[model samples]
Target: MTTSVSEKVYRRGPFPVKFRCLEVLRVTPITPHVVRITLGGEDIQGFHSEGADDHVKVLFPEAGKQRPVIPTMGPTGPVLQPGEKKPDSRDYTPRRFDPVAGELDLDFVLHGSGPASSWAAQAKPGDMLGVGGPRGSLFVSNDFDWYLLAGDETAIPAIARRLEELPEGARAIVFIEVADASEEQKFSTRANMTLKWLHRDGAEAGSTDLLNQSIRTLDFPPGDYFAWVSGESLAMRPIRDYLLNERGTNKSWVRVTGYWKRGHADHVHDSKN
Candidate 1:
């Protein structure tokens, strides 16, 4: 359950293991291009997922194998057969993780034709999957005076989730870019969030200049502020550079990440692009 604003949420109380195996408990569609998959078992009792944008590494089943191989605490991390391959992996924000209920929620943008996207699109209840996390959370607490949240469609779930988590009377500006206006989402946030939708009706998923062009014009507030931006490689770079070079935001206050690149087939783990 979400804690009320009147109560202080404890961060150091407990956090899930750095990594652990999780099974698929259920999967449900939130939108035409987004699916929410909850994964866990008795193993999730200790998991503490604090906020939106916290990622978990999902291990997929290897081809021809019934399931993904669970790693043993070995000398060199993990070891598999010489020719065996690890399942395609992706990074996703933890929408929620209920420790008492032993369940964890992950939201996936089911647009890419990639393995991870396709898997979530076709996933069903009882289907087995693997998860490892509560790895770490990107901190953009409401303690700040203001915030600037921007991203493409792939970042929608996390952005929307964070907005809803903001305390009442807090302030943040949100800019969401999508393929078209029809892809817009209805969101609920306690904070005073002003959202601007940037649409590139026919342009490729992450190639548009909409987000950069708009952010360039906005005058940022001087008080303590945070900016969280995520999306394709080409798009993420411009935003990160602008925040770093122009606004002089410390790397800690500005978390810009490239979730996936347009032409790259594999997901980027530590994207500096």
Candidate 2:
């Protein structure tokens, strides 16, 4: 008997959504403004995150509470318990996940007084936090000749994960904007990478066009490549337009995400490609 073969598929999941209450195992400062909180417990045994940019809705406890109110899994999806006040939650990239060790790492940008930042700032060992639903993962194929990554601090976690996951000899060009030299981070990757760090130097986070300007000056290398651009919502628009309209990049090969929007709390936007 002969079997038919199918083309390789790059995307997976819409996995069952489940909430886990895990304990903070450690907290490390990656940079002056970025914190890495490692969470682990038996509850994380089967936690799944297959994409470099997979995100979990990090649930935070209400004031004076020790643990957040996690939603009960419903027939169709998660449903909040009746009459319970909703918990504060924010979407965060799962920077790393080690299933064997049952550990998950989440990097938080300590900017402003938002719930996630505030929670991460003071998080200590043994503290409990909740995480839910990476819903799905988009696994980009590594067949591209090169890769382009550009964003602000909020995008670092996802970008770093992608870099680390690239096989040796892969080529990647990275542009990251941070507060200053003090906010820059170093990564260990086998891929051939050229990185540029842009400093705001006391300027506002979303007020500059540093990412767009730097990209404009780039002399892109020859070959098909995947491009990932993310950061402030308004800042992402022009960059997306340039890549899609001016450069004539394949729409399906480019992803533009607004990790946050100025003046809007808990805002997350994924621009339509």
Candidate 3:
């Protein structure tokens, strides 16, 4: 029997959006510039995230505030309470979610002086943070013959999660770019993965063509493959174009995203083609 496209590509949920107030349970430094903050609380009871790239809006408290101001969930959507200021928030991938333990892990890359970076740098066990909505999930079937995963430091959390979730014997090729050799991360996965770490050495993030240049030289193995590429906005454009136009990758099987853009605060771009 021939496989149907819908059966191979699954999208689940427009889950009811829920905003939770979670407390930081621990802060672990993963690298010189990356920190992992694990959050847990009674509020984590109903959280759901199945997609490797699922995102949650992390609301940060304003200066002098003990906790972030959360919005009311209305029939239409999140409604701001009257006279209340909306807290500063940024979208972040859910690195790991353990429902049995009611814990969620988020990895933060320390760069510049952004709100998220600043909050993570000094975060401790007692810190309170507001988290809202994975909203939905897009589950790409792992039955593909092989996979291509590429990104920079910001994309590591999602890439790591995906790699770990792949079943035994699955084939995966990964390309990751980081600030330097010191910023590289190791992952534990059952899949047969060929992983490469690209170092910018001392170059500024988003200012180099390292990811695109590296991808250009890859000699892909023959198979039905799923490609996922994400990183700096401008840097990702050429890589996305290369995969779709030059390599003739199926549009529906490729996912490209811009986790952030240079000079722009809290920016995210997604192309599903």
lDDT over C-alpha atoms for residue 77 of model 1:
53
Writing each residue's lDDT as its tens digit, candidate 2 over 1-273 gives 212121212456668888999999999999888999999998897899888888899999877777888888889777887798888888999999999888999999999688989999999999889999788876777767899999999999899999998999899999999999999999978899999999999999999999999998999999988999889999999999999999998777888899889998879657676
**lDDT leaderboard ranking:** 3, 2, 1
TM-scores of the models, in the given order?
0.83, 0.94, 0.96
lDDT of 1 at 99: 72
| Count: clashes, candidate 1 | 0
| Candidate 1: regions farther than 4 A off | 1-19, 63-66, 73-75, 81-84, 269-273
lDDT of 3 by residue, 1-273 (tens): 223346656566668888898999999999999999999998899898888989999999887666898887999878987799888899999999999999999999988678999899888998999999897776778889999999999899889999999999999999999988899889989999999999888899999898898789988888899988899988888999999999998887888898888898979556656
Alpha carbon deviation, residue 230, candidate 3 (Å) = 0.6
lDDT of 1 by residue, 128-171 (tens): 66666654554455788888899987788688888988999989
Backbone clash pairs for candidate 1 read: none
RMSD of 1: 5.0
The per-residue C-alpha lDDT of model 1 at residue 46 equals: 66
